[model samples]
Target: MIIRILFLFTYLLFSAQLFAQVIRYNTVDFSGMAPFWQVESSLIKDTEPDPDEWNALFDAPPYQILMAGGFSQKEFEQQLRLAFMPSMGSLLRKELDKNNPKSNFLRHVMQIMGNEKKLKELQANLQKAQLIKTALSMAKELLPDSFLYARALPPVSFIICDKAISHAPTGVIIDLLFSMDFEAYVPYFIAHEAYHFYRAKIKVPNLPGHNQPEYPIIQMLTQMETEGIADQIDKKKFFLNRGPFAGYEWARSYQHYLAKSPQAILQLDEYFIRMATVPNSDSKIIEDLLPMNGHPTGYYMANAIIEKMGKRTLIQQTANPFAFIRLYQRVALKDKKHYPPFSSITMQYLRKLEQKYYLPKKAEQPKQKSSPKLMWYEKDKVINNW
Candidate 1:
């Protein structure tokens, strides 16, 4: 009995050590400055505390107060387990459902745990899995070659928090959020946002006579257009590596199937499409349209635009982000296709303007002369011409 007790105690000690090691951030070293794991202690406190220090998991009262001061390693780990594990499990189950003949269950199991040890092993194995590396590599290639920095905003994820989803500006921040077991839908979400950041850096031409109040609506439309471009790039890369019917489209179709059968798997495509075109509609329109967490239509419209742009190179010369909006408008007008609810009225207005201004006119030359000449008798020439 004494020997058995000793063995059990040793086992417990080993397990605790392993868990502690797993909780430590191992991706990037930040040892001397401050432990990356110590969220609150490292935060700059003042009249307004640093948002990065804020604990997303402490959704309740006293725990929220505890989080405000910052949490210990043990407390943070507990919060992570409580807040993330179940959601991660759900995501894992969904991924499993889409498993192909080549899918490895053990590999996905390790991803779910996401421990430092497991991550190292996964990285090593990914190096060996040439096919997956190629696929992911292709996806990376489609992204714009620029990094974006938003001054001091805390990293956020697309997870449903208090009935809303938020995104951060940087990919590194996004990767960290994903590490915390946030549900990842489309891989392009990070890449798409990054494109927006890139667009912001360059001077884009403004819409003539466009009102400032309409900026939000136009900005969302621009995001939709860029997202559509990225989607096409992703699709092409995915198809080239994995073959048609193997990549994002397959995942998208599978998601659609799940959404239809299980109301819980809500799709955001319709929501974003509406948001891009209709900013002033009653708030209840969204609630009525997608009773579940007001489906993010912005994200959806981005996806739709990507689908339309196909696999062409991204146009860097265009001044406006939604330069394609004009093209889409022209196509829709010419074809007489149904415009999305948000765009319907806008399109109608554009059509009227196009008819008013876009008309044919014959060019005429000056009656005096085609070439410059010093006319000594300009009075006589003018009188004769008149």
Candidate 2:
């Protein structure tokens, strides 16, 4: 018995060390922004940047991700140009022949960059924050079992950009201008996005058929599971003042949407009923019911699972959205007064969809000392088709 206890202790220690070694954080990719920042700090703030000076940015890993997602080189260039030379806004409008919403927003970003005082302050804050290191530590603490859920932990590349978004090919995009606004909560935001990046690596099933109603239904279920689980990592912290920037705009938006989730869930139930009954109904019709890409509704269901079933159960079933929905139904049915349960028909339809499309492989005992590494070449292939 003593020997067995010792062996267990040794195994746990070894596993912890291996987990630490596997997940890596990188900011070398963000060095691509150095030249652009240099140009911005120059007195030629109003002058259009020479295309060559900032052109290399489009080839950066994060921008390469944008291209893989179907953005064109011309569109990428125009976006960077808008940020780099906000003073040329008039000329940009004339060239484009109409107002571009993204360009309009970047023009405002340029106004801040054009101000030397604000620009220096922003740069100084970012340098002082040690964001990458802090975020890495936070991610480890927030989701210690990330490796168990994901096949491998790819190097998380932190890129400075004008907007925040999830599951970039390499990692998460951080909006440089708004980094300070997040302040002490940067780690939380980064950790949230890191969950998304890791979760994105999980593979789902193939489509049922070409232009089939099942396609949209599968897409909706996938989004709900994806955003729901990721939101579990960070959204609650925002609500509870777990960070310095509590009640910030983004947090407030999440809070607002979450409050509306009950209604949304009810509406979603109705949609699911239609999906189950109306054979020829366009599954795309349900798109209108999902606000904020189904984050709030998904988050609500995830919270239910965490409350009734357990976080471990949710994490263990991370690869299966069908499992996620069923778990939520179990919780909701138990508390029918407070939680609206899915109709039997809707539940049956969902199960039918799952069985038809999702083919789960048999569970195997995890190999000891298994260290799966997702290399850049493999990552690039994933992004190319992403």
Strongest candidate by lDDT: 2
- TM-scores for candidates 1 onward, in order: 0.38, 0.68
50-83 in candidate 2: lDDT tens per residue? Answer: 6666565555555555455554667645665655
- State residue 79's C-alpha deviation in candidate 1, in Å: 2.7
Q: Can you tell me which runs of candidate 2 are displaced by over 4 Å?
A: 1-25, 44-103, 111-167, 206-210, 239-253, 359-386
RMSD to native, candidate 2:
17.0
Weakest 10 consecutive residues of candidate 2 by summed lDDT: 1-10
Candidate 1: C-alpha lDDT: 0.34
Off by over 4 Å in 1: 1-116, 123-167, 174-193, 203-216, 233-322, 330-345, 348-386
Give the alpha carbon lDDT tens digit for every residue of 174-269 in model 1. 222232332222233334434444445544433323454444444444454554444443433332235333344434543353234213112223
Q: Model 1: what TM-score?
A: 0.38
Report every candidate's CA lDDT. 0.34, 0.61
